[model samples]
Target chain A: MKYSWYRLDNSAIMYQMVLTPRAQSLFRMGVKLKSPVVPSALKCAVDKAFLRHPFFKSELKRGFFRPYLDENKLPFIIEEDDGVLLKLLDFSSNNRYLLRVSYFGNRFFIDYFHGLCDGTGALEFLKTVAFYYFDALGIPFPDKNILTLSSSPSEEETEDAFTKYYRKPELGKGINSMAGGQAFHVRGKNFSSTGYGLIQANVSTSALLDAAHRLNCSVTVFLTALILASVAEAHVKGVPKHNLTAFVPINLRKRFPSKTLGNFTVFAKIIIPKDCPLDFESLVPVVKKLLEEQLGEREVILKLGFTSLMSKMPLFKFMPLFIKGFISRIGRTLSTPKQTFILSNMGKIDIGENEVIDEFLFNLNCNKKTPDNVGVLSYGDKTLISFTRKIVSTEIERIFCKKLASLCGEVKVISNFREECNAL
Target chain B: MRCKNCNVEIACKSSVCPLCHKPLVSDGEVPFPTPATKKILMGKFSLAYLVIAVIANIVCITLNFVLTPKILWCVPVLVSFIYVYYFVSVTVLAKRGFHKRILGQALILTAIFAAIKLAIGGNHWIFISWLPAVYLVSDLLMLIFIFKKKNEASKYIATLLLLCIFGAIPCISAYVFDLSVKLPSIIATSVSAAIFIICLIVCRKTIIHELKKVFNL
Candidate 1:
């Protein structure tokens, strides 16, 4: 009967495109990671309150997929329509849990689509949902472990007035205009984690960064270069061509808003230079530098410029599908420095475990299983690098882990990787 | 695309260094090509448009023939006109406002009818269908031009046009079928009202004009 924020519409954007069967399959596999049923009280509270939020209660509807597009330049709310809301509610009713989850059954997870939210926003919702469950259960919950920054010199959130009014309007278009010109990015073929095992190593945040610095690299570069070397050594061996790419998650918090958590993290790929020495020792330095440049704000600006221009061209209105495919293909062939796998290093997650129980468990539920090969690098009290590969061989993961381990000292390889497993 | 060492300047697509034969992306890439998305969507949308228009036209044709054989031809023309106009107007308005091609068609149709009406003078072929034609054309234009692309302005225009058409449908059908049909002026009004309601409902989050903006169109 009522939707809280819909009365005031802050525009939103939704991008839809087809994924390969492999991509679609990964999502289904992802659903298998149904954490335990969450705390009973917390679960009950969330279930009750979830019904109040329109996002959870909403369902997919049929229309020209255009209206839902928030071209107002910012995420604004829309006045909910009785008919549309009713239809969405009806659709969502069948799968309410899709929007909200009892994280880990014990953990909290909100599986929002990336185009709609970034890691910053995702983490915000994650913390909010956890507290919602706790308060609902009438349980004694401590302060939510969310980080908020006071106004500072080095710390900046995406306060871009331009993007605030800039709703990536082209994204709002109905799958129209997708590619053209040097859309600066390290092109990559997504490798799902369906059949891969995770290779993680826990290093003190200080130690981790120190090791990276010792290797003269950043956290992202060290991890990616190591993974690339592992992959090259374990799988690509003597092969002339190693279809290797590193899909790095670029956090937009600095340029975005402190509270903004949506899919603001643009995917910047760093393809290991094709002819480089495959040994882990040789690769780290090269990758360290690439990751730094790839995520630079200027790089994003340059890439966006080309993509924006392409979208504005009238001739490309009906050209996205063709363009995206052609680009992706060319990306495969000519895309050097291509993206092979993504290295998501959620740099040291320090929520001060001194107050938490049995230390904090931080695992990135990529919302859904990614079709792209991925290594989720998170360092809490423990550094766990979970690997997923539907497209590549798991041996690469082994070598990658070994390389990471070698950075500190040496890593011990463990196999028999399971899809639904999580190591802290 | 870039250098491996400094990575600052432009570089050639090769294995060795141009300025500093460092490497493109250490890992060798083949540059394989794949099919594109535009080809897929064009095929998909064109088919959707064709199917929807054909079915709608067929329904109109059947209804016209069954109700009144005398004004049957008008059914196809009017219905087809509506279908064609939808995407066309949406597309043209996206680039520029409605003009030229859109209005020219109306004038051509109007003149042909005027010539026919003068020659046969009012009574030939049951001229009542002409009333709906005038109502449809005038209303559609006003509805389209009033909105300045993606604002609430277009919705009202859309609402108005939809309502006008809702009213014209029944009357036009009756006239083309050559049947003596009596409908209150309120009928036209209520029809338009229903269309407005539907537009509000269907186009809720995804209005086309707004969509163009999101895709940078």
Candidate 2:
């Protein structure tokens, strides 16, 4: 049966692995940031990264992992715009992924969707470009954090795992409709300043992996436990319990060849109920078990089934109106899940300090679309625990930076969401 | 599908109109034409927004298990409906969304949630209840549009609030009225149904009539 559901095409598929979802605010970067904005050196680094690893140009092999535009047949594959995707907002801050550039007074929106690459992979690419850009600018780049997200040695080896699963969309009962609708939250500009704080920690990818192994959890879970602990501590002022949906995006790379430069990640969600008496230590075992089981072959099969259903033939192509409506109605419920926030660990992005590629990938920043309510996470030689929040006070970023410094060895907090580029 | 802004008569399959840089137009119909040359989000945003609202209501079932407020958290739950209304009002259906419609949608959802959570108050069985009621609201809204004015969905906005406020009311009233230790499902359903019928009739005779007379409908 055909439905007037969202369809995709080659453009959606072309830069598939390169697409990254941005927070809506991030999208407005082009319109937001005051311009006279020149392309930053970070952008040049991006040009260079593309030099090393030109995006893998593969045809649409199957339905699952191919870059597919959302219901809106937007041309660009999704990726973060460095203009808004900055480590620190500077004059020449045209920090963007290879394709998406939202600088100046516009949204830092990477005019792409989430069919190309996962947050982890995209961050790797972004950091690589930034590393090169910063080194050239005479800014001392951090240690060469070797890229940890490994590609399957060969496409043939991963074919079975990739092919075994089908797209399976798990959702509640049907609300059959198609078409992108807008329900933008009206933020209160008049929101009185309430003291909220942020802190970023740089836990090396290796150390995080170690913690994950010891805790019997994925690096995501271990880091989540830590974040949860921190939140528990920070909100100790009669901590009002809040239900948190930690949005976790997972790359659907097993079925297809490596989408080395596309947005090809799906949101794998975890719900943490507020006020639940979860001891920090106890959560590790449960999270470890969940991670171990979730990545199994069966899980992928289930996920693929949902993906297949979602990728149902476009209603306008051949299916009758009634059939199309029926199928598309089902598709909508099949796509969404409940979660409060997104915490994706783009595992590790490495940049060598070699003279040729002096500074490769430097610091990490959340997608412009990533809300301050949201947290963009990654771990390499150092962990990047960044938050995208609305600032009510100058001390919010200051407090978070201080807190992060205490959590790990040497940590720096780059305050781009607010006034100045002051690092304490 | 041609480009909306420019006279560029590109392929029905093209995303960018050859002459003008404009989004491809769907001509306000489903079964949008898609060719290899162009990419279109064949799905309608309004429809997706609608679907999200219904599923979101079902997700509210988590409230039964998790510690949370019933009403306030319900506000966040209404975000989907707000989006749906926004789409339908501005884009798909093309009309100014009314406060009553928003209120109605919210109330219907809240009541569905309130009823379901109450049914399986403790046991895991409660989550199932929200789904059926959510389905009912969406289905009934669609069906009602057939009988009432152009958009009957708005007509029942008041009733929806009544449902949320008085959802448990019948039960409470039954207990208060000394109707019975256990009020019959038929009775509660019958009473609500009666009120709804009465409300629809009154609407047709009054506000709707006024709308027609006032706007020469």
Candidate 3:
């Protein structure tokens, strides 16, 4: 009769609050292996990986006060990939599991509901599954750093890092005081249907790194600046330019040491004023300065602490779950208009030194308000920048690839809209 | 392999660049296979049904206007058409759980029956027979499902609880509207109350655990 359940983390609360049929906060991480995926082997790999990371074998349950994760006893089945990017998961049809694993051709994909974990956590699970997949095939992996089936999961792995690292803020000093001004929203006609269109640009990692180094900024900053410049160029002529803000998610595990496999990330709102230079060269330093200021240890902690404090307030804590969910949806809707786009960089992903995987792919789902979102992931020599959009216009994507081609010399483009392109 | 207009290498085997739509200069291996075309099951059938329903309604409305405009005989036909469409889509064809389908059909039927009774200027059978009968049937069906899927009883408990809540409505309406025939409403409420009490007594631990999981702060 008793089942294990977990209280959602502070960051996860926001995700649960805004969860709707239209705005399902879902993201995907996948890898393209050298050989075609064997279904039986992949199934064995998933079963093996589930032992080490049993927290992912859970479902979202609506609690009286909030939503919690309940242990799901249903079999974790690996479905065939449907090719639609970031399709919404129907919990009832999916046996109430919050995550889905599917394979197509040589690629294996894991699409996770954002309430389950952040990108870093999902990447760990994906790597572990891949490691076991190769192991099931009787192939040896070169690197042993991956969490294997042999090791037991640690208690720290399931801890709510936001609560663990939350420090009481000094009186009246640590409250978030950022301006609530609205950012320039990307406007265009949406796709007639309800799925996302993916456009991935594969560039040489070394070339991108060198370009970023030349700009005296990290790859994330460099790419963020480039995207800002692209958005500026694609801005319709004769319209008043508003400030562009990029919602960049920063992984907290790097700053504060915790092995939380739940949601343990905060966002940095990097705003580029309209009057500021919109050129790529000029945007680099501006983005760098803004990122540095917002990404500081103190600032990040303060933001996390403020969120923790808000979630724990007696008023919100005791409120009924349905009312809380209603308020959360409203808050998300009101807050979305203040941002232009999202840029989530998962940084370098290293599963092992094996030659099995050809590349890694990461993608973020777009919402009605923010119809354009980008996900970046680097593996081996290839850095993939995936643009997931709900809109039909590819002007932003076109300008982005053109600029990257001019910078990196050659950018390989792959898309699901090839048929649409032929018609055009 | 290269697209001159976009100045980027074409990764897939498509003839034109996905971004700029310019023809590529060289052929290359496709990294991603073409996505399988999605099959829209029942799309054509649904469209045909909708077209037929629209035409039927239009003909009926025109006939009513010409033959007996003051009576408005087409209204019930329109309501029946709407009810049939909802019943087919949600209860019959929709990929929903059995519990949801049963509850949905029960609620919609009850509403339609009540509306018809009210339209005919009668309210006695609705309170004494129709409403209680619908609630009792829904509650029994939910209980059967819970028992059939005993191992996964937790999954169906919420629906059962919802049916019990609906069971109270007939009794409440009887009192609120001061209906003369109170026996059927009383019987429905008592049955629902007994079921609720029995569930608490028999599966006390499981019910408490479920409640805790649902209401945890």
Q: Name the TM-score of chain A in model 3.
A: 0.94
Per-candidate iRMS values, in order, are 20.2, 26.4, 3.0
lDDT of 2 at B68: 59
Predicted structure with the largest DockQ when compared to the true one: 3
TM-score of 1: 0.51
* Candidate number of the best lDDT: 3
Question: What stretches of model 3 exceed 4 Å from their correct place?
Answer: A1-3, A168-179, A236-240, A334-336, A392-410, A418-424, B33-93, B105-109, B121-133, B151-155, B169-185
**Which runs in model 2 stand beyond 4 Å of their true positions?**
A1-98, A101-117, A120-200, A203-216, A232-243, A254-257, A273-275, A313-337, A351-380, A391-410, A417-424, B1-217
**Which parts of model 1 are misplaced by more than 4 Å?**
A1-40, A43-91, A94-98, A103-105, A135-210, A237-243, A255-259, A295-297, A304-338, A354-372, A375-379, A391-393, A402-424, B1-167, B180-217
Question: Model-by-model lDDT, in order?
Answer: 0.41, 0.39, 0.81
Question: Who wins the TM-score comparison?
Answer: 3
Q: What are the per-residue Cα lDDT tens digits for candidate 3 across B160-190?
A: 6777787788898788768889888888877
Per-residue lDDT tens digits of candidate 2, residues A18-104?
222321112111112222223555455445544433332111212222322121111223333322233221211222222353333
Question: Quick one: ranking by DockQ, best first?
Answer: 3, 1, 2
TM-scores, each model vs. reference: 0.51, 0.40, 0.86
Better-scoring candidate (lDDT), 1 or 3: 3
How high is the lDDT of residue A245 in model 1? 63
